[model samples]
Target: MKVKGVRLYGKDDIRLEEFELPEIKDDEILVKVMSDSICMSTWKMVKQGANHKRVPADVADHPVIIGHEFAGDIVKVGKKWQDQFKPGQKFAQQPAIPGQAESPGYSYTQCGGAATYCIFPNDIIEAGCLWTYEGDSYFESSVAEPMCCVICGYKTNYHTKDRYEHVMGTKKGGSIAILGGCGPMGLGAVSYALATDNKPAKVVVTDVDDAKLARANEVISVEEAKEKGVELIYINTADMKDPAEELKALSVDGKGFDDVFVYVPIKSVAELGNQILGYDGCMNLFAGPTDPNFSAEINLYDCHYNSTRILGSTGGSIDDMKEAINRAAKKEIKPSVMITHVGGINSIVDTTMNLPDIPGGKKLTYLQFDMPMTAIADLRNLADEDPFFNELADICDRHNGLWSAEAEQALFAHYGVK
Candidate 1:
C-alpha cells in the first residue's frame, strides 16, 4: 500500500513523502489517522533526529514517521485480534511502551500517526496502550496524551501532614498555584484542576503575558470556576516587583500555595514555584527541559524546617489518558481549549520543525487532507480570501472561538476525508 507521511532522516532532517508500505501480518491492524497534535517533544526529536533516544541511529538509511498524540479509525483487523478489535472503530493510543526502544511516532516507519494509514503492531495492541475511543471527536482523543501529562501533575503530586508518610495526589480543597500557567499544558492544568472531583478551594494561575492570561481567563472564566465551588484567579507577573509575595497573598490567610506546579522549564519559574511553597507544600516540576543539566536554586530552609518537598513527573500512565477521555466525553473538561491552530497532514513538516517559533497552544493536524497551517485567531482574517475560513471562523465563534466536534465535522466535510 502507498501512504503519505512525514519521515525523519537525520539531525534536523524531515520530509513529507509518499512511501510503499508492505502488507500487514496476521497479528497487525491497520488504521486511517484523523487527527494529531504536534508536541514540543516532537520538535526536540526532529532537532536531534537519529541522536534522539527513541529514534533509530540509522534513521538516514531507514526513516521513522513523526507524530505521537493521534487518533483515527481502524481500517483493517487481522485475524489474531478480530475478536478483540474490528475495523471502523475509533481508536487512540499511548506511545510510550515501558523499557521498549521502538514505539510509534519516534521509532516506527509504518506505525506512526503522521501517516494517512499506519499499522498497529501486535506488541502495542497487547500492551493495552491502544484504546478504542468513544469520544465526540477525533481531535479530543488526539489531545488526550498531552492532557494526560497535565493531569498527571495533580495525580502525581503529594502532600504530607507528618514526616513519616506521604499523602498521594494534590491536597484536597487546598490552595493550588500553576506557575507560568498560560501555555497549552498550563491551561490544561487549570481546566483539570477545576473539573476534577477533588477540586481545590483556591486555584491561582500566573503568566507573564497579558494576552495569554486574558485568553486563559476567557477560556476558563473565574465565574465558571466559582460555580464549581472554587475561586479561580489569573495573575500577570510580567512587571510585578515581588511576584512571589503577590502570588502568595492570593492564597488563603496569606500563608502560601499548598501545591505549586511549575509549567515552564525555566530557572526563574522553578525558583518562583519554590518561593511560594506553603507549610507542608508540595512543588511539582512538571515541565521537561531540553537541557539535561537544568537546575534551579530551591529553598532548602523551607524544605527542611517547613516540611516542604519537591518532585517531578512526566508522561501520564494509561489510566490518566482514560480519565482525560472520560472527562472530555462527559463534557466535564474541554481539552480542546489548548488547541489554537489547525492544518492537514501536508503541513506537518514545517509545523513540527518550527513549533517553538509558532505562537499557539496545540497545533492540531488532520491527516485526511492537505491544507496550510492556519491559526484559529487568524481565521477571521482569511475569511474574505476563502469561504472555508469564513465558515470555519463562524463555527468556532459559535463555540467561543474554540474547536468543537461540530468544527471537526465541518473540516471533514470541507476537506473531503480520505
Candidate 2:
C-alpha cells in the first residue's frame, strides 16, 4: 500500500513524502495510525536525527519515520496471532520495547505513527507492548505513553531509610510541588499527582507564564483538586524575588515539600528544587537536558542529614503503559488535558522543528493530512471566515477549548469522514 509520512534524513532534515509500504512478514501486524501526539522527546530526536542514540545507524541511507506516541486500529493480523488480535480493533503501543536497541518511532525505517500505515515488528508484537484500547478517542490513547512514564516516575521513586525497600510514591497526604508545571509533560505530572489514589495533601505548581499557569488551572481546576482532597496552588515564579523561599513557605510546618518535581532541565530551577526538599523528600528531574554534561548543584549536607534524594527517569515500562490505559478507560486521568493543538500528518515537519517555540500543550497530528496545526483557542477567530471552523469553535466551546473524543469526531465529520 502507498502511504504518506514524515521521514528524518538527518539533523534538521525532515520531509513529508509518499512511498510504498512493503508486505508485512508472517509474524507482523499492519496498523492504520489514527492519532499521534508530538512529544518533546520527538523534537529532540528531530534535532539530533542521525546522531540520536536510539536512531538506527542506517537512517541516513534509508530515512526513518519520526513519531512514537500514537494510537491506531488494527488493519491486519499475522496468522500466528489471528486469534489474539483481529482487524478493526483499536490499539496503542508502548514504543520503548525492552531488549531492543532501536525503538519504533526513532529507529524503525518502515514503522512509525507519522505514516498512515505501519508494520508492527515481530519483536514488539511478541513483547506484548501493543495494547488494545477502548478509550473514547485515539488521541487520549496516543498520549498515554507519556502518562505511563509519569506513573513510572512515581512508582520508581523511593526513599532508602536503612535499605532500598521504603517506597514513597509522592508521599501520601504530604505536600508536593511541580516546578515548571505549565508545559504538557508538567501538566501530566500535575494531573497524575492530583488524581491518583496515592494523593498529596497539597500541590504547588510553579511556572513563569501566567497564561500557561492559568490554562493549567482551567484544565485541572483548584476545585477539582479540592474534590480529590488536594490543595492545588499555581504560582508564577517570575513575579517573585525568592521563588524557592516562596515555594518552601507553602509547605506544612514550613519545612519544605515532601515531593519536588524539577520539570525544567536548567541548573537554576534544579538548584531551587533542591533547596525546597523536606526531610526524606524525593526530587525527580523529570526533563531530559539537551547537553550531555548538564550538571546541577545539590546540597550534600541536606542529602546526608535531611535524607533528601534525587532521581531521574526517561520512559516507562509496558506495565506502566497498561496502568495508564486502564486509568484512562476509567476516566481517572484525562490525558487529553495535555493536548492544545491539533493538526494533520502534513504539519509534522514544521511542528517538530518549532515545537519549543510553539506556545501550547501537545500538538496532535491525524493520519489524514489535510488540516494545518490549529490551536483550540484560535478556532474562534477562524470561525468568522469559515462555517466549518465555526462548528469547530462551537465544539471547542463545548469542551472548554480542550480536545475531546467528541471534538475529534466533529473534526473527522467536518473533513467528511464516512
Candidate 3:
C-alpha cells in the first residue's frame, strides 16, 4: 500500500514523501492515524538526527517517521489476530519497549504516527504496546501517551516516614510544589496532581512567566481545585522579592513542601526545588535535557539529614498509558488543556522544527488534512475569512475557548470529516 508522511533523512532534514509498504505479515495490523500531538522530544530528535540514541546511524539513507504520541483507527488486522482485533476500532500505542531503544516514530520507517497509514508490526503487537481505545475523541487518545508520562512522574516519586522504610508515590494530603511549572508537561502534571486519588492538601505552581501561569490557572482554575479540597496557588517568581524564601513560605505550617517537581530543565529551577523541600521531600525532575553534561546543584546536607531526594524519568510505562487513557475517558483529567495549536501532516515539519519558538502547549496535527499550524486561541480572529473558523470559535467558546470533542468533530467536518 502507498503511504505519505514526513521522513527524517538527517539533522533538520525532513520531507513529506510518498512511499509503498509491503503486504502485512500474519499477526501484524494496519492502522490509519488520525490525530498526532507534536512533542518536544520530536523537535530534539529532528535537531540531533542520527546522533540521537533512538535514531539509526544510517538515518540519511533510511529515514524514519516523526511522531509517537498519536491515535487512529484500525484498517486491517492480520489472520493471526482476526478474532482479537478488527477494522474501525480506535487505538493508542505506548512507544517504550523492553531492550529496544529504536521505537515507533524514532526507528521504524513504516510504523509511525505521522502518516495517513502505517503498519503495526508483529513485535509491537506481541509486546502489548498497541491498545484498543474506546474513547470518542481521537485527540484525547493521542494525548494519553504524554499524560501517561505525567502519571509516571507522579508514581515514580517517593517519600519516607522512618529509617530504611521507603514509601512509594507522593505524600498524601501533603504540601506539593511544581517548580517552573505552567509549561505543556507542567500543565499535565497539575492536572494529574489534582485528579489523583491521593490529592495534595496544598499545591503551589511557580513560573517565571506570568502569562503561562495565568493560562495554566485559567484552564485548571483555582476554584475548580478548591472544590476538590486542594488549595491551588499560582505564583510568578519573577515578581517576587526573594523567590526561594517566598515559595517555601507557602508550604504547610510555613515549613516546606512534602513533594516538589521540577518541570524546567534549568539549574535555577532545580536548585529552587531543592530549597523548597520539607523533611522527606521528594523532587521529581520531569523535563528531559538536550545537553549531555547538564548538571544542577543539590543540598547533600538536606539529603542526609532531612531525607530530601531526587529522581528523574523520561517516559511512562504500558500500565501508565492504560491509566492515562482510562482517566481521559472518565473525564478525570483533561489532556485537551495541553493542546494549544492544530495543523495537518503538511505542517508537521515546520511546526516541529520551530516548536520551541512557538508560544503554546501541545501542537496537534491531523494526518488526513492539509492545513497550516493555527493556534486554538487565534480561531476567532480567522472567523471573518472562513466559516469553518467561525464555527470552531463558536464551538470552542461554548466550551470556554478550549479544544473539545465538539471542536475536533467540527474541524474534521470542515475538512470532510477525516
Candidate 4:
C-alpha cells in the first residue's frame, strides 16, 4: 500500500511524498488516519534537525515521517485481530512500534503521526493504548491521543521521580494554575484538568497574548458550571516584569494556587513556578524546551523552605490516551480551538519548515491521502471552512506573511527564535 506523508530530509527541509507500506501480517492491525495534530516535538525536529540523543539515529538519516499525535479508524485488521478487534471503530493510537532494540523501553518508537495509515503490533492492541470507541467522529478521536499525553501529567508523581501511575480520583477542590496557558499544550492540560475528578478549584491561565487569553476564556462555559465547576481566569504576562511577583499578588488573599503548571519553555517560568508555591503545591513542568543547552537560575532555598514540590512530564502514556478518549467523547473539552492553521499534506513541507513564525498555538496542515490527484490542490478549501483556518489567515496577515519559511526566519530573528 502507498501512504502519503511528510518527511524531513534535514533541518529546514521537509518533503511531502508517498512511500510503500509493508503488507500487514496476521498479528498487525492497519489504521487509516482520520486526523493528526502537529506536536511541538515534531516542530522541534523540523527546525533543529534530527541530531538529538533521544530519537533513533537512523530515523533522522532516512526520509523520516513527521508527526506523533494523531487519531484514526480501524480500516483493516488482520485475520488474527478480527476475532478481538472490529473494523469501522474509532481509536486513538500511539504510533511507535518497537523494532530490534536491546530493551522495549528504549526500543519502541511511536508511530509517525503524519501518514494516511499506520500499523500497530497485536500485543500492544490488547493493552488498550489504541482505544476503540463507538459513535465517535474521527476529528474528535484525534484529540484523545494528545489528551492522553496530558493525562500522564495527572497520573505523574514528580516528587518521587517514580514511574507514572494513572489512578482515578475526585474532580473537586484542587486549584490548577496553568503557566503559559495560551499555547496548545497548555490548553490541552486545561482540558485534562477540567475533565478529571481532581478538577481544580480555580483554573488560572497565564499567557503573553490578550487575544489568546480572551480566546481561552471564550471556550470555557459559565452556564455549564451551574452544578459543580472550576473557576477560569486568564492572565496576560506582557505587563509583568516578574510573573512570580504578579502570581503572588493574585493568589487568593495573597496565598498562591494549589498547583502551578509551567508550560512555557523559558527558564524564568520554571524558576517562578517555585517561588509561588503554596503549602504542598505541585508545580508541573509541562513543556520541554528544544535547546538542551538552555538552563535557568533557580532558588533551591525556596523549594526547601516553602515545602514546594516540582514535577516534570512529557508525551502521553497509554493510560492518558484512554482517558483522553473518554473525555473527548463527553465533549467536556475540545482542542479544535488550538488549531490555528490547516493545509494539505503537501503543504506540510512549508508548514513545518516555518514553525517559529507560527507564534504560539496548534497548526493543522491537511493531507489528501485518500483523495484523487485533483483533490490535492483543492483541499485547502476544506481547511478554510474550519474556524481555526480563519484565525490562521488573520494571524498570517497581521504578521505580514511571517507564517512562510522565508518570512518566519526574519520574524524569528527579530524575536530571537534561534
Please report the candidate that would top lDDT against the real structure.
1
TM values, all candidates = 0.98, 0.97, 0.98, 0.77
Considering only N, C-alpha and C atoms within 3 Å, which residue pairs clash in candidate 3? Answer: none
TM-score head-to-head 1 vs 2, winner: 1
What C-alpha lDDT does candidate 4 achieve relative to the native structure?
0.60
Q: Each candidate: what lDDT?
A: 0.89, 0.86, 0.88, 0.60
Candidate 3 weakest ten by summed lDDT: 159-168
The candidate, 3 or 4, that scores higher on TM-score is 3
Off by over 4 Å in 4: 47-50, 53-55, 59-62, 96-111, 122-128, 157-172, 221-228, 240-245, 369-418
Candidate 2: tens digits of C-alpha lDDT, residues 235-303: 999899888788899997688988888888999999999999998899999888889899989999999
Model 2 lowest lDDT segment of ten: 156-165
Clashes of each: 0, 0, 0, 18
Candidate that beats the other on lDDT, 2 or 4, i.e. the better one: 2
lDDT string for model 4 (242-279, tens) is: 77767766665467766778888888777777777775
lDDT of each residue in 1-418, candidate 3, tens digit only? 8888989998999889899887888888999999999989889999998988999999898899889988999999999988878899998899887667879999998888899899989888888899787987999988888999989888888876567687788888999898877887888888898889879999999888877888988899999999988999999988988887898899977889988999889988888899889988888888887777999889999999998899997798999999999998999998988999988899998998898999888999999989888898888677677767887878888877689998898888888955
Candidate that beats the other on lDDT, 1 or 4, i.e. the better one: 1
